[model samples]
Target: MPNQKKTKIVATLGPATSDKETLKAMILAGVDVFRINFSHANYDDVRERVEMIRALSEELGLYTAILADLQGPKLRVGVMSGEVVVSPGDTITFRTGKPFEGNAEEVYMNYESFPQDVKPGERVLLDDGKLIFEIESTDKKEKVVAKVVQGGPLKSKKGVNLPNTNISLPALTEKDVKDAIFACSLKVDWMALSFVRHSEDLMDLQKLIEEHAEHKIPIIAKIEKPEAVENIDKIVAYCDGLMVARGDLGVEVPAQEVPLIQKRLVIRAKKARIPVIIATQMMETMITSLTPTRAEVNDVANSVMDGADAVMLSGETSVGNYPVQVIEKMTSILKSVEGSELIKVPHDPPQIRTVRYITKSVCYHAALMANEIGAKAISTLTNSGYTAFQISAWRPSAHILVFTSNKAILSQLNLLWGVKAFYYDRFVSTDETIEDVNAIACKKGFLDVGDMLISLAAMPIKDKGMVNTLRVTEIESCPV
Candidate 1:
């Protein structure tokens, strides 16, 4: 149990790593979070994985978080009679409903508003941008006539991308509501809403969660669309966390811009004290090959050096031949880069609101003081996990040990960078809780004799959403 690496790993569970033994191996290898993709799994599949994750975490005595990813309102072509081969310069008709006879000349799309929302000259990408179409005309009926700029064999249910159109689809589909209800019932730690366009899109999901759940499950906005990038400020302010989902994002935006966007998103989340996950194909080659390309290794390392809270593995772990190997390699890369000069460089704290200013200042100062004093850990007693998140954002050299009585909050912290969260029994006094954590740290070997522990907490311990105190103390006693 100890995660010596600063950056966390989020492993998607599928046929490759779903069994109890494989899950335990993945945890031991280095998976901090388990992601259940609703786009791929049914209710039964999700519930089974959720149960297994909980049971395995308890058996292994670890705090592992689970994220439920909503597919959102994805547009795709309906079932084709067979494969349709289209060459460049071919004219095709895209209709909203089922086609009477599916052929190469005509195709059906599932989204009802696709025809009206899309205008002439806008580009339509299919099968992950493998084929491109330029809309030439829109008829009185809900049909679009398009010229294929890049053509290939089109299969049934392949993805459709409207790169140039302002998508009018709602962020939440009927399927998303059902998935959210199911996720809440399982007490999932976080839910990712895909294809978020603006802050309003996030508000819609937030309202749905509030109306359906007793627990407050945090939402992580999947920033993939260009509209989301344009409105990132408002979206970041509204959501609890963000995911740099570069798969569709790379397709939507220019591929060359993804690196800069990833860096920008990480910095924005850091300034806001929200966790950001760099996801999609981090170790993709490992899906088949025993090892990843050297370039892929650097990609994972670069994300860690960019201060990403977590790096995700999609198909690499979901259905790959080397699930555990991918985790091991990713963990190794993170460890190597974490100790490099790039990661040690300090960043200037961004200008923020007054309350956040104070917390960030305290966190920055605590990290400096801990490094100067050779502290073993920066410990925080957090009620809402906000204080711990800020401390992690500061990227302290010392390990972060968060003591919380709230199990849900503790689970959420599992995804935070450089955070090691543990639940403590309820105490009558703040001093009692601090003392208990101090002793627990020694017992758990997170601290050794004479090692310094920088502690942060808020005044009036009963109050939530405040981080106003900092103390540095030396570990003097043995484990209690």
Candidate 2:
């Protein structure tokens, strides 16, 4: 509706976008979602930023969604003395739950069960697989001895990835529980659980939210662990959304396998009718350089062609010098791909045996009819946002214009592909409500005189039941 690309862009909020002016510019540049990563954020700063984003969204008259990304059981090394170097054939010792000056030979780790969980021959990768170590032995008390297989300069508090060992840590840690509660208090539109091992992890998080929050927020499962990749089908069906967290996933498995894994996850999510995002290092080279590497540009383009709902940027937006420029460039790439036949995503037919088959069929046909007649938009009245997600999954040529009275859902649909949500109440007569939304659409410039609009809504509109009505209207002109 805003002349934007169908594939949304999600930018991580940080020092680069802390200023109000920069954030507004990003919104204008088509950043549909702002992600607040709780992994290394200061709570006070996060609260302040959330306040600013909501205030600015009202001021700018643009709908924006906020995603609270919970840091789940992220293991790391303790503070080092300063920095040390190691080479192949070097030996290092990591002791758990003890204060010690970190050095080349010995360092402290935060995870208390590291020594108990690690075993001989398991590989340990640090600093995003920059340094690799093979476990030699562990005392099973407090010490783990490893030999450097691939080494580099090690520093304090570097991320540790145990690719070969199954560390026994709950998907939601104590910190994550507190963070989820805080995020609910902020009324963020979406919550993403990092390092989600399986679908049960989402149930664990939902239980926590149901206990503390007034409403249940939609969640996105971060598929970063090998276990999550293996359990992707269940995870896709259970969670509201999915994110292919390639950074940690590539470290967990071979880097060469991540591309295929990302494609597979996207397909599963699409079939389940859930939004899936492609994240991590999408435009890493643009962090400092004004332009992205050829490979980086190609990566974002491929994600769009693969039918991802959104593409996310991490350090490139949070700590990069060219945050706004990076978004502009990403948008340019998206538009280029979206204009081509390559962006045609697969369509999933409804299962007649499913209980909701009729609703799904209505949504599917709405999209199909809209495309057949070259309609300008597919308008739908949805309270639960179910039809919006359903129609969006079809990847229709026409934009999915969603009219809803649910205030929380207005922002939630922003992450959906090809969906533009509007806050609409006053469900009067079916004809009157349809006219009301059509007028709003024309005023917003998505439709003009003589444009064909395919609209769907439930009959007896006040009942607010499942979508059961479909109509095609020709927009002549709205009264002054």
Best model number under TM-score = 2
- Give the CA lDDT, 0 to 100, for residue 422 in model 2: 92
Candidate 1 wrong stretches, greater than 4 Å: 99-101, 344-360, 426-431, 460-465
Cα TM-score of candidate 2: 0.98
Q: Per-residue lDDT for 1-480 in model 2, tens only?
A: 466599999999988878888888888888999999998688888898888888888997767999999999988887777769999999999898766779999978888999899999999999999999999999998999999999889988889999888889998999999999999998889999999987888999999888877766999999998989888888876799999999999999999999999999998888888999999999998889997989998999999888999999999889999989999999999998875775666766797657677889999998888878999899999999999999988998887999999887888899999999998998999999999999998888888889899999999999999888889999899544
lDDT of each: 0.86, 0.90
**Backbone N/Cα/C clashes per model:** 0, 0
